[model samples]
Every structure is written in structure tokens, then in C-alpha cells.
Target: MNQLKVELIVDNRVNRSTLSGNGIRNAVSLQPVLYVGGIPNNNHINLTGSGLNAYGFQGCLSSFIVDGRLLDYQRALVLN
Candidate 1:
């Protein structure tokens, strides 16, 4: 009983996010994007930390789907 589901759908100018856990579902719509990025070739991306992830997010994601593709999340990364 320790599972949570989060879904974010971006359409046009609005962003809709839904969170469901513990048999309850909640949804919200906002204008700001859920994911933020820096301008291309600009050096002031993370000005607070000098190009570093100073205000980034690090969390545990068991699995996620992108463009109908399912990804199994893990801590360790392998390069081939």
C-alpha cells in the first residue's frame, strides 16, 4: 500500500497534472510548465549555482511512460 501515481499532460498552453494514491485521485490545471529548462546556449540557466542543478529535483521513480514507451527506473546507470 505504498504506491503513488502521477500523471502530467501538456496541451496547448495549459498543463494538467493528476496525482492518485491511497485510492484517491486529485487533478489540477496550471499555466506554468511542469518541466522547466534553460535557454539554448545561455549560460544563466542555473545562475544560482553556476550551471549546476541547484534547485533541481531528485526523487525515486519506479517507472514512467514517455511517448507510449515504458521506462524502468533505477539508481545505477550503465553505459554501453
Candidate 2:
């Protein structure tokens, strides 16, 4: 299975020795949403970047746990 892991730790300061070999982007990011891609909405053509690209997530999210708590993305989507 092709897998990729991205761990973001929000901390003040910690021992760097404990850090793993994972791709650790040490500096905090200003734009939280690093990657952005979506289908164009013809209805809202006035909106900027509406017809950008179609590269949104395309796979089943088996699991998404944050702080040891499993999140309900499907339910959230329906609510919104």
C-alpha cells in the first residue's frame, strides 16, 4: 500500500533529539492549507481562483485520528 504520513506538532520547545526522520518542516506555516486544488464553479465565475484545477483528494479516508480521538469527517460534511 502506498502510504504517506505528515505529523504536525504544536509545541513551544522540545528536545530535537526525540524527533524522527519524518519530513519535519521545522518552521511553522502561515497558510495552514498548504495544498489547494478544486473544481471550477461556473456559477461563481466572479470568484477568484474558481477554475484553478481538479486535484482534490481522491481516495477513501480509512482513518483520521487527532489527539487520540477519531474524527467524523463524513458526518461533518453532511452537516455543512
The TM-score, computed over Cα atoms with residue i paired to residue i, of candidate 1 is 0.28
Q: Which portions of model 2 show Cα errors greater than 4 Å?
A: 1-5, 8-55
List, residue by residue over 1-80, the lDDT tens digit for candidate 1. 32333444433244443333343311111122223232235323223312124354455444545557764334224421
Report every candidate's CA lDDT: 0.35, 0.38
TM-scores of all models?
Answer: 0.28, 0.28
lDDT by residue (tens digit), candidate 2, 1-80 = 22223453334332222222223332112233233234345422122222223346554555555557776778856864
- Candidate 1: lDDT of 27? 15
Provide the lDDT at 60 for model 2. Answer: 54
Superposed model 1: Cα runs more than 4 Å off: 1-54, 74-76
Displacement of residue 78 (Cα, Å) in model 2 is 3.7
